[model samples]
Target: MLVSALCAMLGVAPVWVSCLLFAVAGYALLWLFSPLTTIMIATLTAIAVLSFVKPHAGAGSAVIAFVALTANNMQNNLTASNIVGMIIICLCPLSLGFGLNLLLARRQAAAALKQRLDREHTARHLHDTISNDLAYMILRIDQASHRDPPFDQNQYQRQLADLRAIAATALDHTHQAIRQLEHTDGPSTHIVQSDGETDKQVEQQRKRLDDIIQSQRQRLKSLGFQGDDILGTFDQPLTDDVLDLLEGMLNELYANIAKHADPNVWYAVTVSFDQRHVIVSASDALKDAGIQLGLGSGLERYRAIIESVSGTFAVTDDSGIWSAEITFPLCRRL
Candidate 1:
């Protein structure tokens, strides 16, 4: 109706007025129509034809009409030289709006990919680190319960408390990963830090690993298997990323041993580390277990995590003993 009024004010003929109305209506409907470009092009062509054919109208008048219609609709007063100039100016908003929408969509897609990667990374970390530690801890607790001198309740309770703390910390780390996903742009947070305050966090993680290993040894003793030499040897400090990955890998190995290894079988875990690489060798009896050395179902996921940090992992099952060797370059601090 406003377009019709504007055409009337311009003293256009009835035919020209009808053409102008058709063009305006067509443009408006384009928003809800398929092939928007087709609709827009048709509308612009109609307006041009009407402007040329109208008795008193000329190129200048047509340009003025086009500019007026667009300005009125967009609530902007813009002037252009000719009809062609007016059309060009009118396309500016549409171009900008479309470009902006595309940019935002791309950003959203990138963020979603990042979140998925993070989730997988967390899963592998937990599987490799926490799972192994817990298995070892459970084994120790089992052994402690069957001690020859009779299990000391106070010592057992202390160990149990320590286990609970480790479990709690793992849960906390998982929660932090979840929160990071939920609020990707909210703030920067760290799972563990190297600052003086983070010393306590580091000690807690180390203690948890120690407790789990101790528990496994105790459990082995109760089952009549000697586990005297199953100790972790750390010759070099581990970077945060490497530590996280190793912890996850060890957890998976320990869980596998607890679930499959026989009570009478003896096992030993030796961790050798240097500035360039780390190797974890597990020597255990597995002749009757029928277990093969290869990438287990869980290892496929673990492999992805290791690869993300430019690392490599390999497993060798020689006779009844299995050794998982993971080698990766040290990540330099930026």
Candidate 2:
């Protein structure tokens, strides 16, 4: 825009190089900043530059020259023909600017479309992680029976603190993950979906899963569950989907405890790996004091998550003790 305006104004000025400088600066700003904002500002700036360029011809003169130039076919007036030529020469750069702006508008739309798609994809992955953890907390609360609510004022207070910490962690992770999603590989940078997630992306997700386990452990400990809780450490590499599924299952298990398990019962978590498959299991000493201790819908939901990746899910009530196990072959590469 600045270039076009300068070219329009300069016409044949002694300091014509100034127009080139303005054009360069305008293009630089447009490329470095948002195309939309730059185009708007640059368009106005171009008009301003044109106004100050001291052209012998303008909108008014161009109209007159157009009429005379049209008559030049029949009339023998050199001056009118020259005026028409000048008008065409003066309008060339402005026309170029108009076309350039239009091209930029198309590019802007493409970029926005790219961003929307990437945002949705990232949100699904990130939001699922946080939402799954949060759902577990909610389920725990819903499942707690008031028959003989455990803890006194201090216990209730501690439970409140633990809930707050868990929620805070989820909120923080949601914000950070989504923010990274939007900016880390901006809209202009296209990702080939067919290529799947890169090594770095897979590694980052694995780390996130580890953090989820750590935070969940802290939450369980705060709720009076500490002995032998599994510290999830895998000796083998796994695909992103498997890692996510594993983390989600553990989160669901915790939620089940929050919902069904007796507060006074002992809880333990176990995670193991064999030659071909990894096993993640949990058990609880039941208070069975007439409570149902059933899996209900939670079990089905967890089963679906595990089985989606061809994994197996099972829950057993051996005497007064309750145990659940999930196992799947690891996909080492993403």
Candidate 3:
């Protein structure tokens, strides 16, 4: 309805009126499309041909002008027929503009779909290569836990910390995914200089890692464990992707400890960086109750995560103690 009324604004019969009709249609088409140059030639040609036409627009005027022009041999003047023709001519641009906009909208939608597929490829790359390591870390924790006896309060506290870490990391991923899907002309996306934003994201990664380590360590300390108790130290710049992988591993490790590790044992989790490596080592001088257990597949997944970042990984089983070491290299950080 609005389209028809707006089209009627060019209802008058004049060369300028035709220009106005085409101009409005062209603008609408441009709005519906991207890379305006792609459709500009077609738009100009169609508007030029269709916009300038017979002027008689109303039903009665159309009949009168036709009779005057053909039967009475009149030439080059607005007659009743021109009035009807103007209505029909204006209607052509209106319909053509509507159709062009629809076609352009479809093109935009296809482009958006392609961008989404590209984003999914990126996400799958991370999940397939890195996230698979969570399994290995969990298995080690479970192996240790089976030897320990239950201490309700300590176990619960540790579990809570891990659960929060898991929740936080999942939420971060979900929001990041959503942004990837709906990203265009938003404040979160910078149109200009993005170095500051990168710095800010790196800072956030550091903070999240610190919080996870601190919370779990606090639980350990309350039970008279300190110094060598669940220690984690980060002394280097961190990337968001590496931070996410580490966060997931840490949370899973904590959960495994809460559920499987000896309640009375000491554990140290440390993170330090060198020119070539951002290394993480979790070692526990586990007080084994000598419960024989099979090693789970979690270690394999852990190995995959480390290797995906081009890091050397080791899961050590020696003299009744278990440790998983990952040398996450700075050279390969993403």
Candidate 4:
């Protein structure tokens, strides 16, 4: 509008002619250069401003119209004030993105710090409590072995009593530390159905768990793994809570395999039930045996969960192979 008004005031060309020229030049430059058009327009504008070559209306109008169109194309204004405005516009998003990145980094740092502090606290507690008790117990046993008679019944009994007391104290201290650690993990996941839960709900939960197991078996087959996925029959339906826990554990197992196991190698996932317990076992060949697999926190959490239910969880790395087993006492069958 401003360029057209200026052209009209100078009696050089009609307003519509100036607009048409701007539209044609902008379209042609953009269609031909695409991304490079931004650089070309900038360069042309800079040269025209710096060289101070005042061409007549015919040429000047084309250049002015193009410069204005370039500014408009970039969603900016072609005016002296817009120089600072453009700088502010570009910096706004950059500053926002940088601020968000800093916030994320700060949160990550805080989480890492808290984890370190917890580990340090656990270390200190073990040293202060268990280490001293173990040392004293060892010394007492050593002294007992050096008795002159080697079988002074009364003295032996007294030493045994003292040892028992020390052992009990150490056990209590250990339990205390474990309880404190457990508290930090928020709520406990109990694999037992609530008293109010119905049998139909339990059946649905069991079906969901069976579906997950079937999917895992299909995935193993699709991945070209040789495995016997023996999803054994359950004589009695498992509780909903138990099913939920098993679902999570199953997902974690498959995810770990997907990440680290070699699909071409043989693998096995077996589920069985005895009178007292339900057993799950899995083994896979590692993709990279040279890389030692650490006992990651995920396995540790599951270990704790199994133990909390009076169950056992074990994992081992034998050469290039990894195996894990979890056995939990049959959750009060629905």
Candidate 5:
């Protein structure tokens, strides 16, 4: 359009001829200069030449036409428009995108808040019903054992049967609450699910851990790493939370190895469980010194996870080898 306008103003060859020439010259100039440079050079050259020629519409029309063309051609150029015009033209889509992102963030926050409230309600339910029942049973037992009376054996047996009935009812109610909580969407849902079918849950946990370990080992093998893994049998029960985190921890560890380990060297992953704690460790030779390594956010995140559960995380870099160890407790404290 600019080419046609220029040709019309100058009474040059045909419009098609001018456009073809401009396109060819533009395609060549772009090979040598950036788009902005080419635009500036072309505009200045045209204006300089037009200054020598007779003025067309007082020369301002040609200058305005050039400015319009330049502005339309460059999306991010400061010369696109006046402030208000720029805001209306360019910032509308950006503002819409930001508004959408804010809405999504708010929705996520609302969901998280709901989950937290649900957990609190479940905790309160347990304390209100289960705790009171247990306390009452304990008091009755104490009174039965230490009361100054002609102890009635039949009455005592009746009280014991009542206490047992109370305990059973409380246990049933506790299981129902746990089931409801397990259905809620959150990180801790799996932990709640752990309470049902102990043998099945334990088997699933073991399979998950073994799968993660074997996956990492296979990945290392594919990377030409000769690695060893000692997936020792657990001596004690691992808390549901600890078992859940192990999956993430192992993935992060293997990811770190994939990113930084020397493919030609040996890596090792060892799992050892004692009565009190479970130990997991991985070690690998570092890649060449020339390869840059980032500050391991993965390790830092897992460190926080371990420490939150009263577990410990340790890392050591020595003699071109990197190693990390995690020691987590077997029991989950109330």
Candidate 6:
């Protein structure tokens, strides 16, 4: 509206002056208003200038001056030539704004996707590292409860109590991880600590696997499963890396059994070690519902950890029984 008013005032001047004002007004409108509006104003200004100017100038000179004058007219004119010029000016801003908006939208979307990926990565890391270690701790505590020579009974009891507390804490952490996966917000920055203190954490964690099998044995017996003792030997003491991975695997297996296995069925867990590798296996009788075949997220993550350290995993569910087998190299010996 301001540009239009200015153009109106300029139109009252001589043809040359009016042409200059028209050009300025047209350019201003192109910058401020829609491209279409700028073109319309320029077109109108061109026609007005041509109509007001006399033709007494020579044809060639008239043509040249007309062209020059029209070029100077920034205001939209009613004439076709002026209209075209206004349209060209208006298109500049329209195209530029549209392209800029598109680029910005894409960048925002990419940033959002990256944030989601990072959050998921953090959740998986927490589950694989922290949750698994806690599970292993529970297993070891349970095993310690059933030792042959038997360390102090009170100490064993205390350990069992600690195991329960750890289990509860791990469950809470699992819930948090699930929430994080479902969230749309940015990634968490909090750091997680694993249970083992030294480089031997992994070996220590592996020994705890025997404890888990022992505890499961008791649970199975209570449910009327007359099973043999779990058999396994460790070639090396537990290290932090092995402990972290095994803990995750054990937790996944326990969860599956708790959620899907029949309470009345018998099950056995066994581990065997050689100079080169260690194998851990769990076998359980299936209920009428049968064992679900697909690997759960916990197990899948464990599998990934195992593979990352050059290990192998296999799961089998035949008839009504399920078995999981994991084999990994013994990198650090006891």
After superposing candidate 4 on the true structure, give the runs of residues whose Cα lies further than 4 Å from its correct spot.
1-206, 220-224, 332-334
C-alpha lDDT (0 to 100) for residue 333 of candidate 5: 39
lDDT of 3 by residue, 1-334 (tens): 6457556666665768766766667666666786555344443345434333322223233344335435433445767776566555434554555565667678999889867755654464345323433433354346446656547889766655664554565566566656655666333442443777666755666777788778656544543344353334444455545665666666555544443455567777777666666777776544464643223444455567678767788777676566777777664544
Give one digit per residue, the lDDT tens place, for model 2 in 207-293: 776676676666666456655665545544565456655665666676666545666777777666676677888887665645546
- Candidate 1 deviant stretches above 4 angstroms: 1-91, 121-186, 189-212, 219-225, 228-241, 262-265, 287-293, 332-334
Residue-wise C-alpha lDDT for candidate 5, range 1-334, written one tens digit per residue: 7556645744656777776677666656575768766664555445434433433422553446445755675775555355446344333333444455567679999989888867754654565445544654564466456766447889667666767875886698689678868885546543444445666756667777888678557645644577787777763346755665565566666666766788788888888788878788988888875444542655675576568778888877777777888888777532
Q: For model 1, what is the alpha-carbon lDDT of residue 92?
A: 46
User: How much is the lDDT of residue 206 in candidate 5?
Assistant: 76
RMSD per prediction, one decimal? 13.3, 13.3, 14.4, 24.5, 25.5, 16.1
Write model 6 residue lDDT over 236-323, tens digit each, in one string. Answer: 4554445545555555565555445666766666667787777778776666644366677877866776777678888887887788
Model 4 TM-score, 2 decimals? 0.38
Q: lDDT tens digits, residues 1-334, model 4?
A: 6456545654576777776767555656676668666654544544333333333332344445445545675664456666555444443433444455567679999889878866755654565445545655675566556656546789767767878876886798799779867766555575665644546564666577678667656645544566666677565666544664566567567656655778788777777777778788988889898876754655566677678778998888889799998998776421
- What TM-score do all the candidates reach, one by one? 0.50, 0.44, 0.41, 0.38, 0.41, 0.40
The per-candidate count of clashes, in order, stands at 14, 1, 24, 0, 0, 38
Clashing pairs in 2: 140-258
lDDT against true structure, model 4: 0.64
User: Number of clashing pairs, model 6?
Assistant: 38
**Whole-model lDDT, model 3:** 0.56
Q: Candidate 4: how large is its RMSD? A: 24.5
